[model samples]
Target: MCKAKNMIIENIDELTSRGNKKGRRIVLELVEETLNQVNYYNIVKEVTKLTNDILKIKDLELDLNGFKNVYVIGGGKNSSSMTRALEEVLDGRIAGGVVVEKEGYTTQTKHLLIVHGGHPIPSSDSVKAAEEVLRVLNKVGKDDLLLVCVSGGWTALTSKPPRGISLEDHIAMHRLLMNSGMTVEQMNIVRNHLSQLGRGKVPMFAKGATTIGLIAVDEVEGKPWGPTVPDSSKFSDAVRVLVDFDLLDKVPESIRKYLETAPPSEESPTPLDYMNNCLKVHNLVIADNIRLCESAQKIASKMGINAFVLSTSLRGEAKHVGAVVASIANEIANFNRPFRRPCLLIFGGETTVTIVGRSGEGGRNQELALSAAQYISEGSRIVIASIATDGTDGPTDIAGAIVDGTLVPRARRLGINVTQEQNEHNSSFVFKQTGDAVYARNTGTNLMDLILVYVE
Candidate 1:
């Protein structure tokens, strides 16, 4: 490594690696800083703040008004944590509720029923438990208030099927949608519009129950995915998403047939009537991608690096996106444009990894890091990292990976090429051999990935 290259690596390592050395302390310090930024305290604080902004019907003494009982219902990776926050706010007012969350993450409360469910795909248990919830919803009357806590993973965790549609059909369609190239927002537009349980099924069934969503948003767009407030999407709009993505032809045969035959009618529910009460009553957005972005920036600044928040809502394909970030770093090195030396450019958002083949060990973030390696000049002074905030990126324990300009030769030495591997979605294998994978444990419930590039 040249003098400038060594300086850049030192600066990056100082921010990512932890130890007692000057660089180590700084790296540890930064990780801690970002970690602290996402502590239960801050998450609770933001959630509390949002909840407070809503109409405080509790102050009106719902019990006194004859709308006595308050029930909790939720689904997401953040569902359990969010339930805890809701319990703190509602105190003893909560009668009882059910919440489904990722395995090993549960929050028990006096009145909350926590259910463990699958993610990225719905399971039989999710449907069974969700059906049980529907039974509970059938019990709710006009006077009772139902507090629904919807977050990132709720789509798969909560469920009800449309007439004549098989559970297998729904599951297959969901899997295809996730693996498809459509964004969460675009996917949800079609999903919610199509499903009986979605498009405000919870709210409509529990009509006038004061539905509230404690959303931990994943999309870059300000509006949370799925039906939050009044879902503005029409059935045609939903179909158009499939058309635009060219994925309508790829969805499960049953789902495609259903979509083709389904009539456009007023009974085709969306989050309209319920949205009035839903948005007004909804409390927190447990957290957002921007929180993680700012946290990374603060950490980089502490490392004596000039930090820049590229964007909180960056989106697009993982490969193209990685290439763009790499281009920026190259420009910084050659032209010192946008940012000069000792710069840490940070971006946050969820990127997709399209696997057209059998597969290998890798997530979208890792693939992005590998693809970026080619754009970095050999011996150039730049290092980049892309990791999911949730700690686990994709199915692997590795959160993301870190790459320096030397990664190109490093991959070549391992009998791999960056461009070729990225095409195969074999980033995990490529980085594993070159030692660029960034694995972390306990990243918590936050979704989305963070990209950091240190350039000199």
Candidate 2:
């Protein structure tokens, strides 16, 4: 049996040392195994190989002899890991390039310049990284090969607002999007129109070069999330999202006016670019949520626990999803309608938290965990856990949280009101008080979020 390449849970001993030991142990084992399966470096290394000067990644192969220079560039939470793997596989064949990673998520790379940038918000480093990538793209020739390593968080890591938009306005636009209840896809659509490096423009920059994208998908369908993939959204679609979310008036006036009156010439490259050979690109999904969910299910089955993947496309409010998961667990624990006890149920997708007024600290995963704790009954053998696979939940360092039936009572004993915390979106504090917060460094992969429920 192949062992897991990476184990990211830093506090597994602390987490399992107190909670219903056996159940936490099993759930964490699933976490470790599933995360190992999606390690960005491992996934890329497994699928990509260079033998006899020929590069093969998945079904695509390229003869390096035809290329004068090979470069790797892109940005995200997983950029450094992917770039490191490519550097290893390609060895000295790489001609040097630039890729940006969220600060503190970067790993060592030899030939590539790894620029640490800001995420969840853009900073000067983000602009600097964008400029560096553009510099590299400008150097590419028709015989050059460009490897675009993309993953979640790439938008913020390589943000470059348009000509008329200020960095302050760009930041404001993101702030509004975060609180607008819009999904990541919707936000990316709007961002695609405003940012210089977004909306499938990276490949366009290296138009005559052979561009191959190594993407770590956070969405269920694994659609385009950054520069390498063709953006299917239009300027009108971006305008529609802003209007529907009622963020038109709330966002910067420049952003509003740009999206509202942006001409067709400013639109992103469509599928026509590929059909006409104007953009030569190949995108490969190196890792995704479904594969992570399936790995959990497979691991559970091997452990003699019945497992079912509820959904890979879970969305909507974080707290509401928590309630739904708790309700389902209640059904199984009480009467086993949809599933039996001693079963492992899994869900994978990104959930949103629509911030209103002054919000407290927490991410969607933490809020979901806190909300699920409300429905858990005393002495019920249920362990519900949610985690953002990228390892950071919101602006906090916590990956997510785990809860059992006794969570509320335990929190009460410590003077932590679970309901109030959830209301204020202060889930990290609640989890901290209850000793249920999960911690891990960046797991070297971005596949949205994962929630697991183990009932007995």
Candidate 3:
């Protein structure tokens, strides 16, 4: 279990340097406590156990004596932490395995090959990791046991481009999808169509082995996707998403041709196909976004704060979501309209940033916080903050940013142009200059982004 003392945010003093001391304390405390509550290691430990050769996960049980070999495999932001727990529970039962994770996010392991790869985009290392994992999976036999640990960000961490498509073209396709304002689900649908180790293909390589899928989700449904579970999306769906986003021409010609060709044999396993296959699969959602938000709400309530979870499915562009959250807070503070004053509103989910020409550094959460700063009034006493649960926002090391009513005036005094920063997608630069950027190393877990609004 994660302790409050094990803070993922590295620059707490700097973040609390300018905001209302009490408000900053409350907001930062909520972030620290919530992250601890939903940590992957703790969640995995809660649902899994082993005793005298009978391995149990949640309500399912398996007799380890029947299997000749037990192999652990999969990848994601939190896979390393999840693997640590699995290694502890199973002890020395694990024969060998290959697990992939984002660069700089690996943990110490005894019986597994931990491969560090790229994130938000795949690199040559990502492709190599995918190959290594596939090679391990192919070695599994009918009597073998396969433990698949997957989390958000697995799509990029284990990359294997399909035949006729080069790695460069594959990476270019992902870049287009990221900046095209498509949701993560939409992006994965396109990705599931063009990879060898994705869309439930990993399990296919196991050669009839029984597979247990442990998933950590970023949305409310808790439904698992990617390599461990069957994808309901088809080639046509990928083509339509590209067309809907107007990215058909912008994506690489190889990807465009692959999606347009829509080969039936290359299609991912449908739900029915997966069910009838020889691969016996059991899937469980270990943790999710709603669980993370609820933990935050509960912690605030215990502190005598009126906290309410607005939605765990918050979506749309980052800038727009920020404005709406600020507007709601404004109404509550000035008019007591939707919610009364002295309340904490919580939101969770991933947001997209549609990059136009000349994009700047930053992620969606930082953009959200920066946009909210524009509408805050000095006397409103409203504090708005956003952070990626994984402790890395966008391509930067900052987790997210926090802003208050004083942010706009501070920017003016500093000679910073808020609108220009937003237009250029430069939230990281603005927040860093103002000492409000929340910095942290990778948290070894990801559910999505968490936004908190405190009105006093």
Candidate 4:
């Protein structure tokens, strides 16, 4: 059972008062319930059926007696919780291992060495964690069974640059890719080429071990940077992404030269390579945004609101997507074209913010909610909210923001200009002043971002 914590909100009464208080409460409840459904404990119970001598994950089953040793290795935002569950299932049969987690998300574990690292940016600690992971991989024997936990934030949490690529250069390249507004897939394509453990490097090193990847699919499908799975990306794809972002010349010289000089044929290893190398690898997605969205839809139905799930794979610029969702809500309110009145629309996916100039204190979700506020007119019966599942949005303490039609007018009455703030990329500042920002301490899990729209 997952322990319950106080749902953090800066001014709870102030936010609930915007939309119908009862309606706002329903929304908050639905969000909280959906999060609980995908919590680590629930996910482990749902995906794996464990016994004293046999462990089954989906269609794959492992006999504990067949392996000489069992080790757990991988890293991400939810790795600590996942490891705890595995520890309970394995019951002390597992050998020593190492796993990296995002800072502040670590939990007490008995067997695994937990290391905290940075996110959205890789620190020296990330490199240290990666080294530890590599050492574990090297120590695995031919008869060993390796249980891998892959989840969101792995790209940044386990940063290990290839030889000749300095950490400084690697950090600069990562920052450039993030601000370039590239999709997660594109960013990871370029990242796979720069790191040693990325792009099937881990599986390649564990040439003789049987590996099973228990993945928590967050943003993208198939776990793009999965360390234990065979990477299907290519070096050409990395070059193309850099070119598309117009970052060919702007990125660090080391990165540019490495991709330029590296052989194009050195693509991610294929399944055939793994098979020929005498390795067995299985990957199972224990949870994802689709599950989260479906749970929200069910809760909305129980609350007597007509609910429609927009898309679990929503992508693109945050501000534009926000405006588009607001337009849809406007149409629903005016004509009831898509659905009737008293309806709830939900969307889930990761969005990008292309930082052209200096960026302000906000994340993609906050920016999206602030942008939606522009289209909402006074007395308009529409409310929109965007939140990150991990609780924090960007570097701000707030999870995200909730805005209604009256939000803009309220800001204007306070001598604040919403448009100017949006232009300055200062949505967090605006939300702070207006008491619209949603606050929650680190939720210990991440499945990208969620957007909720209510039209009545």
TM-score of each: 0.83, 0.97, 0.97, 0.95
| Residues 1-456 of candidate 2: C-alpha lDDT, one tens digit per residue | 223344588877778877577788788778877887888889889999999998999999999999999988968997788899999999888897997989878878886888877789888888998899899999998889999998888888889988888999999888889877788988888888888888678877885899998888876555755688777789889988988998888899999898888788788887786667676789887788888899889988888889999999999999999999999999999998798778999999988999887688899999998899899897889998898888899889999988887789988999987788889999988888778899986688888999999998
Which ten residues in a row are the worst by lDDT in model 2? 1-10
State the displacement of the C-alpha of residue 347, model 2, in Å, after optimal TM-score superposition.
0.6
lDDT of 1 by residue, 1-456 (tens): 123331312233433442113322333335435755774334754545324323243222233245657777777665666667767776666677777776644555456777776666777776776776777778776677776666666767665557677778788877777767677788787677555557455666675665655566777785554434446777677668888877788877766766666776633454455544453344446567777778878767666688899888888888889999999989988998987876778788887766565666778888888888888887787777787766667767676777776778867877887777777778888867766666554444565767777776
Please say which candidate is ahead in TM-score: 1 or 4. Answer: 4
Per-residue error at 350 for model 2, in Å? Answer: 0.9
Error of 3 at 374 (Å): 0.8
For all candidates, the clash counts are 0, 0, 0, 0
Q: Candidates sorted by lDDT, descending order?
A: 3, 2, 4, 1
Candidate 4, superposed: residue stretches over 4 Å from native? 1-5, 8-14, 17-20, 221-225, 263-267
Candidate 3, superposed: residue stretches over 4 Å from native: 1-5, 219-221
TM-score-superior candidate, 3 or 4: 3
Candidate 3 lDDT tens digits, 1-456: 224465787777767777675687789878888887888888888899998999999999999999999999859986888998899999899988988988777777777889877898999988888889988987899899999999877888888888899999999999888888888888888998888877788778888899899988875345776587887888999999999999999889989998888578789887787778866988888888989899999999998999999999999899999999999999999998788878999999988899989888899999999999898888778898899998899888889998998887888789999899999999988988888898876576789999999998
Of the two candidates 3 and 4, the one with more favorable lDDT, higher being better, is: 3
Question: How does each model score on lDDT?
Answer: 0.66, 0.86, 0.86, 0.81
Query: Which sections of candidate 1 miss by over 4 Å?
Result: 1-32, 39-41, 46-67, 104-111, 263-272, 275-286, 302-304
TM match of model 2 to true structure: 0.97
